[model samples]
Target chain A: MFLGVLFSGGKDSVFACRRAMETDSVVCLITVISENPDSYMFHTPNVRWAHLIAEAIGVPQLLWSTRGEEEAELSDLRDAVAAAKKSYGIEGVVTGAIESVYQAARVQRICRELDLWCYNPLWQIDQVEYLRLLVEEGFEVIVTGVFAYPLDESWVGAKIDDRLIRELESLQKRYGINPSGEGGELETFVLDGPILKKRIEILRASKTYENYRGRLTIEEARLVDK
Target chain B: MILIVDLCHKAESLSKYEFVDPIASIVRRTGSEFKVRHFSELTAKEIERSDGIVLCGTPLKDDLRARRIELFIWIRDFDRPLLAICAGMQVVAAVFGGEIVPQPKIGLERIEILKETDLLGPPGEIEGYHLHNFGVTLPSGFDLVAGRAGQIEAFKHSGRPIYGIIFHPEVRNKWIVERFLDLG
Candidate 1:
């Protein structure tokens, strides 16, 4: 079956796209860019650069914009998905939702309305184990945002590796933070992965941190050879 | 050993990770051994060797109508504790002479447990994750365990330990799955 993934250029969505590719053809990558940085429905950090990730992965991308109002953005999502169905003839939609019922349920409702099958490959997954899987599976993911305490400026631009995974595991036990950032404690962006045809090279980026909230804005990036 | 039967559209389909693996993970976390097999690939020998059976859900778009519902004829005679979820519930109900009605639901909703069983303890209201295009009617010879008669949220066989629930227990109600394992 041909499917379209709700891509955020994040580790979860990237990994989900790869998993979807294993069983079926991922015909397109659908990215919903929200103006609200704290949008509950979609990931926000450096999502506009999703086209680059799409180009790197060699999948056609469908970009949609939303004003990011809480309930109103869902209609924008519906429009985007409807457009994907019309353009790509996608039979279903794939999501990276792991534990957020709020996000997963809304997407499920939209898919049902659109008569498209929805798949959340990372639903109810073990967070720490999944972070480990991301590194072990050759996914070069970096933290792009941090929202919770005890995670300071250092995490904003760090690559996810064994050392970071160990630290996240310890933080999970000590501070009750979700290692995979399912709880909105952190956000990630995938630069390279097993499924990507090319890797992302960050040319220049700026980091901003204050009082346990931080974001790494990728000002410039280009696709490079893996 | 618990047998987790995958009811997705096909064996090893993309839906397996969403529907099957989570339940398998929950069962594994209980320290009980489990084996996962698609409904079409399940053998009588596999069923006979299992202590309990958990028929997992599927993507809402991949209901049992696309597959051979007759393959589930084994459910009628199997006396072990069997818990069917979502599409699996539709199969269990269809096998037992029940109607599969169009009751499309998605997202987290309130579930009222009308009849308490070993699987779901006591009658109360609890929120459960529901993602299905259809729901099963109360199959004959099955007691209404939850929800109203027509819109059965949960049901159990009158004489056996067989059960069917529309909600995906692997979501917020994983205790139900762990409790089903305990029923083994």
Candidate 2:
């Protein structure tokens, strides 16, 4: 079956695209770029680079813009999925939702309304283990955002590896933070992975952090040969 | 050992990691051994060898498995402890003379336990994750353990250890599955 992945240039969505490719044809990547930094549903940090990620993965992308209102973004999502179905002939939509009922349920409802099957390949996954899996699966992910206490500015712009995962695991035990950033505590961007035909090289990036709320903005990046 | 039956649309489906593996993770965390088998690939030998059976849930859109109820007839004779979740609940109820009705639900909701049982403990209110497109009516010779008569959140056979719940326990109430494994 041909499928379209809800892409965000994050580790979860990129890994979900790989998982989808394992079982079905990932025909396109559906990207919803929200203007709101505090968007309720979609991820915001460096999502503009989703086109690069899509190009790296060698999949076509359908980029849709949204005002990022509370409920309006859902309609934009629906429109994006509808467009994917119409243009790419996608029979199903896949999401990277792990434990967020708020995000997963809305996507499920939209897919249902459009008469398309929705699959959450990472539903209810163990966060720490998932982070480890992402690393073990050869995904080079950089922490792009950090929200919540106990996670300082150093977390922003750090590469996710064994040391980072161990620190996150320790924080999970000490502070109850989701290691994979399920609670909006952190955000990630994938640079290289087993599913990517090309790797993304960050040329220049800027970080703005204050009081544990920070983001690493990729001002420039280019795809390099893996 | 607990045998987790995958009731997804097919074997090795995209839904397996979503629906089946989470339950398997819970069982593993509870320190119980388990083996997962697709409903279409299950065998009596494997079923008889297991101490208990857990029927895992499927995606909301994968109701195609429900129409193939003939594959679930083995559930009627297996007397060992069993627990059904969501799509599994529908199958168990259908095999036991219950009707499947369109009762779609998604996301977290408050579930009121109607009666005390070994699986769910005492009657009270608890939030559970629900992601099902259909709900099953109370089957014959089964007692409602939660929810009202028309909307059955949970049920168990009057005489057997067979149980069913409409919510996905892997979301928040994994102890229910742990308790079922402890029943062995």
Candidate 3:
């Protein structure tokens, strides 16, 4: 069956897409750009890079702009999925849902309305195993945003690898933080993966922190030949 | 030692698989050492070297399905403790005189074990994450041990160390893998 992935330019979404690709052909990547940075239902940060990463994966990207109003954004998601269905013949929509009952239920509702299968390959699986596979599979991931204690400014622009996974595991022992950043403790961006044709290079970036929250603004980036 | 026969080969063409990796983790969780080999590379000598076997599933692509059918027939006479998952189970059913038709209501369903067995260990409810478009019929001389809404979920040979399950034990039931390994 053909699939359309709701890509958020994050490790979870990109990795979900990879998992979907394992079983079925992913014909399109759906990216929603939320106007609200504090959106609860959708990711807003590093969204501008969704297309570039989609390009890197060599898949057709379907885009949508949402006003970020609470439940209204879900309608925009339906519209994006409709467009993908009409254009790509997608039989299902792939999501990066981990342990969020709220998000999974909403996406499942929308998929039910659209008569399309909602596939959450990462749902309820062990996060430690998920992070380890990301490293082993050569997924180039970076932290773009952090918004919790114990994870400070130093984490803002760090590449996630085996070493980082260990650090996160230790932090989990103390703070009970999610190793995959599912707790909104941090946000990530994927620069490359096994499926990507090119790798992204952040030539310039600036990190800022305030009151335990931090962000690395990617001022410039370019795709380099792998 | 157990052998994970990863039939999701022809990786140069087919997509990378995530189906059986969790099984690998399950093996490690049981403190078991296992080796993975592509189905094309599997041999009788290899089967003789292992304690048990787990045959993994893949999409039923025509060429790959042909290769799989050949392999199932090739290994039909295997007497070792063997467990197959999803597509692998479908392969077992097709090879052992059973039916495989397109699945009608394909979604998440709770499977209840209808019969008792050491491999299931007092089975009551097992959560099955269903995705395949096909369903398998009980093969000849096999017990219909599990089902959901009358659809078959598991079956075992009448008198052999072989079993086939429709759901992914790696996803929801680590105990099932442990039980299968224990049969070795």
Please tell me which predicted candidate would have the highest lDDT against the true structure.
Answer: 2
Instruction: Report fnat for all candidates as fractions from 0 to 1.
Output: 0.89, 0.77, 0.00
- Model 2 Cα shift for residue A18 (angstroms): 0.7
TM-score of each: 0.98, 0.98, 0.72
Per-residue alpha-carbon lDDT of model 3 for B9-33, expressed as tens digits?
Answer: 4542222234455677678778989
Better of 1 and 2 by lDDT: 2
What DockQ class does candidate 2 belong to? high
Each model: TM-score of chain B?
0.97, 0.98, 0.87
lDDT of 3 by residue, A1-226 (tens): 7999999899999999988888789999999999998987777777887888999999999989999988888898889899999999998888887766567667766776678867777765678878998989999899999988888778988999889899999998899999888888889999999989999888987888998798887778888999
Q: DockQ winner between 1 and 2, please give it.
A: 1
Among the numbered candidates, top DockQ falls to 1
Error of 2 at A124 (Å): 1.2
The per-model lDDT (C-alpha) reads: 0.91, 0.92, 0.79
Look at candidate 3 and give me any clashing residue pairs. Answer: B103-B133
Q: Which stretch of 10 consecutive residues in model 2 chain A shows the poorest summed lDDT?
A: A123-132
Q: Which order, best to worst by lDDT? A: 2, 1, 3
TM-score of model 2 vs. true structure: 0.98
| Predicted candidate 1 versus true structure: per-residue lDDT over B1-184, tens digit per residue | 9999999888999889989999999999999999999988999999999999998898888865435878989998999999999988999999999989998888888999988799999999998988888988887899999999767899999999999999989988889998999896
lDDT of 1 by residue, A1-226 (tens): 8999999999999999999999999999999999998897889989988888899888999999999999889999999999999999999999999999889988888898899999998889898889889889999999999999999999999999999999999999999999998899989898998988899999999999999999999999999997
Q: How close is candidate 1 to the true structure, as a TM-score?
A: 0.98
